[model samples]
Target: MTILLVEDEDRLAAALIELFHAEKYLADHALRRAGKKTPVLMLTARDEIRDKIEGLDQGADDYMTKPFVPEELLARVRALSRRQGEVLLDELRFGDLCLSLATNELNAKGQSVRLAYKEAELLKLLIANKGVILSKETILRKLWGDESDAVENNVEAYVSFLRKKLGFLQSSVRIQAIRRQGYLLLEEEAL
Candidate 1:
């Protein structure tokens, strides 16, 4: 969690650095050449949209303006960290296989597979709702944000997509469809 405090104010920057350090954050000042890895956060007094965009475009995971509440900034930073970690976890395992949330990469008994965007989203939703029978309406609402506009059949299509991807990935977990009810993300052992 390296934070790039780009504020021109010496005293304020120093205080923020100290505060982040106290929170066990490995924060640093100044920007460096971007490469793979390390979350960056930019803090500046510049409230302009251009400044915010520039900061993010420069590889900062999050950007904050000055005179902001420190707690709010901390919350944002923590959320970003959690999201990143969730994506990278090696295996969302049910039995013998695991789903890579980071890359949508899958590994099962030595086999590896990639998931499409919609497939991954649907799989994630199912996993999040593991053990719960997710109704078609509920799944549609979650995916398309509007149940009325998007047909319920889209959920069925996506579930099929996920099942195919998971099969290719050799995952033990299965998406079980209950007639007239909905779908459930069932672990191998549970089934």
Candidate 2:
């Protein structure tokens, strides 16, 4: 799972980022431009009712004030992750492959394989937009959000992993790279 820290304080941001990493979460600072699907836990020095309300109203999935306990912050982050996962419970199917969003498992040809969070998310995006080329920039922005640190190589890595999983499952679905365009999911003909 990933967490975006929007705290402007450098020292606080570093400490929180370290905590999240220690907890095995992919954590990063908030981007300049928002609109990320990833669950956000906004941390700020403002500790007023109106401030919290405004943060939530501005699209933060969760909000916390300064001088908070680490345990509570972790718990809130977990809750947000759970909530996001709940929305993806519906299974996605394309050709002979089935992706279970709840379990993050992919099944095909009598075999089932588990996927990491990012891998499952990337696969879902590709499958959802089947036959449509998704640009590297789009994938980065959607999956990794607008974090400037994320690069095209990150998208390529995940796509490579998904391709290996598909090959292992012997699925007809293929992720095709369209040179300068991007990637598109295609069902291959049986030989």
Candidate 3:
């Protein structure tokens, strides 16, 4: 998979780009001028909570703090690639809700709405494992990678976004938070 490595440190960027190349993964040091379908792995020395949050908020697929292990970095990249490949189906369905991976749209009843990258990824996860409770940690790892500084609240925020989109489409499917358990996608009548 192609990785956009946004690192300002010259030495670190060169090392990472070399490592990714050695592992047979394409990597670039600069950010693309336009949005890309390829996953991004942001490498930065900024480790403050707000910095990490801002990186994620601005659409970095995953974030890695400086002083990281090369092994862990490779693993995170593989995880992102795996998740990218897992959704081979063009569309996922639950009740009346339809999530289109190709178009990045969520449709329900007679309405359809485009989804942001992360939103579509989160919804795809829930729908792929419908009726299963995915813990906040699991969601965080699947969507943001383990190396990311994202917390449970990040998952909650995305869940809230998907919930609003579902509501906007008048969907019968609901993303139900299971308190101590996590979240499960269920039909409204099942709740």
Candidate 4:
């Protein structure tokens, strides 16, 4: 027998990784608590109301008992997937850069850089909306949630971080800041 531990910093990957891989009755409380909010579906043999209640309170977005029908399982997953407006792909690309959704690593020109979780999310947002202006309000709402205390400075800092990484990679892609507007992703030649 072998054991594995999944500790991805990305919330979605971290929450779901163990569920698909591990089937034991054991629940990794620490794993569930690893990152920020994620859509988690807890699967276990325990069918008790108390168990289900505890699971839900412990951060599970959904719960399933043992011997679940495969179709129902798929449907539940689909529902959770829709909860997050953005469907995470294996990778996202713009110009010469590739952002790995699973590992939060950005690659360009044969070189790679690991980004902090927030940095990755910001970069993903920018890539998904390449050439479109994304206001600070929009970025804050989407990435940090409306209720978060993150201010414009937070957004500015992350943007600066991404810019430095892009420079280090020597990628043609660059993030352009619109005065009193927002930020846009554009290749250097597009200037």
Ranking by lDDT: 2, 3, 4, 1
Which digits, one per residue and each the tens of the lDDT, describe model 3 over residues 15-35?
A: 676687456455566674566
Off by over 4 Å in 4: 1-88
Worst 10 residues of 3 by lDDT: 21-30
Q: Write the per-residue lDDT of candidate 1 for residues 91-189, one digit (tens) a residue.
A: 455566566656777677789888875676677667655788989987765555441477888888888888886788667788999998999888677
- TM-score between candidate 1 and the true structure: 0.53
The alpha-carbon lDDT assigned to residue 133 of candidate 1 equals 91
- Which parts of model 3 have CA positions greater than 4 angstroms off? 1-88
TM-scores for all candidates? Answer: 0.53, 0.54, 0.55, 0.57
Name the top lDDT candidate. Answer: 2
Report the alpha-carbon TM-score of model 3 versus the true structure.
0.55
Q: What is the C-alpha lDDT profile of model 2 across 1-191, one tens digit per residue?
A: 65667887755776786677456455666642465687788988899999999998888888898889999998998798789884423477888998875788899999999999889878867875677899998788657655458899999999999999999999988899999999998889722
**Candidate models: Cα lDDT each:** 0.69, 0.80, 0.79, 0.70
What's the lDDT of the predicted structure labeled candidate 1?
Answer: 0.69
Candidate achieving higher lDDT, 3 or 4: 3
* Root mean square deviation (Cα) for candidate 1: 14.1
Candidate 4 residue pairs that clash: none
Candidate 3: residue 96 lDDT (0-100): 94
